[model samples]
Target: MKKSIIYSLIIFLFVLLAGCEKDEPMGYKGRPGVYFNGNEFSYSFAENPWKDIDTVLLPILLTGDLEDYDRKVKAIVVSDSTTATGDMYELLEGTIKAGEETGYVPVVVNSVEELEKSVVRVRVQIVENEYFKELDLVYPACNFTFTAQIIKPYNWSQLEYFFGPYSTGWWKFIMEKLGRTSLPYWDMWSPIPNPDESKYNMSYYEMSNIQQMIRLELADYNKHSTTGPMKHDDGEYAGKEIVVPAPW
Candidate 1:
């Protein structure tokens, strides 16, 4: 009876070991596959670009295994009639090497003309190639889309209450540099003085105050054709004549 009991215990241990081995996770055993790091990408004419053109980089990741040999990955732009084209944007194609976990596809916005007409959309997809396969099950899958919109230079109706007719060219300049419809006065101004004389020589608070005064003076000039209470009363320029400073 004792011999039989010991033999049964040994058989049970062997079965448990075999079950654990069977359940083990498979890690990096196959060829590398590609997927976008995220499901969607977006850009806005107001928020993204500082100038006429801008570039956005989308990341593609490798899965399954890191290999000793280089893997070539291909991506293409997917678009329809509703999508923006021509002067609006340019699509890019590229590759990833073996053992590289990430690669980038650069989407360049050539102009904002399409945005003026309507919101523009750009779509891209990863297709199966000789070296890499598209992963459809992933979050970004083999397909992703980007949307761009114009949100700056508030219209007359939007600014009339606070700024009246004075909120024209300068307002657009501020929006372009700050990338927002509303100004955050407190954040732009700092109580601490800047030590770097070569840069601006004034505290952030002082600089912001100067800008505010400039706006108020311009507003008063528009209303009364005369300067307001600001000590540094620079001459006012017509809304159409005002030009954006080269460097903000």
Candidate 2:
């Protein structure tokens, strides 16, 4: 009878151990939630409204405890008919630090021209991760949508219709002279000019060309400013025989 009781006790212990192991959390187990701080983010160039933007950093937050080791979270910019791969914007996949809840993903604007054509929409989401998961019951899932607008500095029709043939040098001359005071506007166009030159992706020439275009357009506006007795108008006043106060 004692032997029978001992055998039963051993069987019970084995079942209990098996149950515990089955219920135990795995090495990567845990509800790690990911989300963006805001639903939408927008930006425009201040200096030259037509100029392309450099980069936009989207803030991401993770909730719950992270794994003991750092893990890479997969992020993807959903492409649609309007926003396709290698189009106006590019996808940004970033990592979440170990034991940290804050991270940032960079959504790079590919073309200033495309932004000017229309409002570009970039849809990004925190996709499935072996280490993390989307928060349940969240509206729209763990996704963020951003709209970027590129405002044209000058009316294209007016620039071409009113102004005669203009060269790039003429454009550069005005930008250097006028763009200096419009620093606040220009600062928005790029975080830093030519941020990475080692990648052989220097944009000095492209940026210079864009700046010149804006300057030329502005100069045309100044040249065509209509003067009336009602109010005094500001002119380019840069080597003009009739100098007037600029209406900044």
lDDT of 2 at 53: 49
TM-scores of the candidates are 0.49, 0.43
lDDT of each: 0.52, 0.49
Error of 2 at 66 (Å): 4.1
lDDT of 1 by residue, 1-248 (tens): 99999999999999999988877645444655777766555555554445578666666777776666766667776655227666777767655665666666667776455565566666677788877754664743333333344332212232322333343355554454444544322221333221122322334455345456546554554568454321221224342333212213
TM-score of 1: 0.49
For model 2, the superposed segments whose C-alpha errors exceed 4 Å read: 1-29, 46-53, 66-68, 81-85, 137-248
Candidate 1 whole-model C-alpha lDDT, 0 to 1 = 0.52
Where model 1 places Cα greater than 4 Å from the true spot, the runs are: 1-12, 15-28, 68-70, 140-248
| Top candidate by TM-score | 1
Q: How many backbone clashes are present in model 2?
A: 3
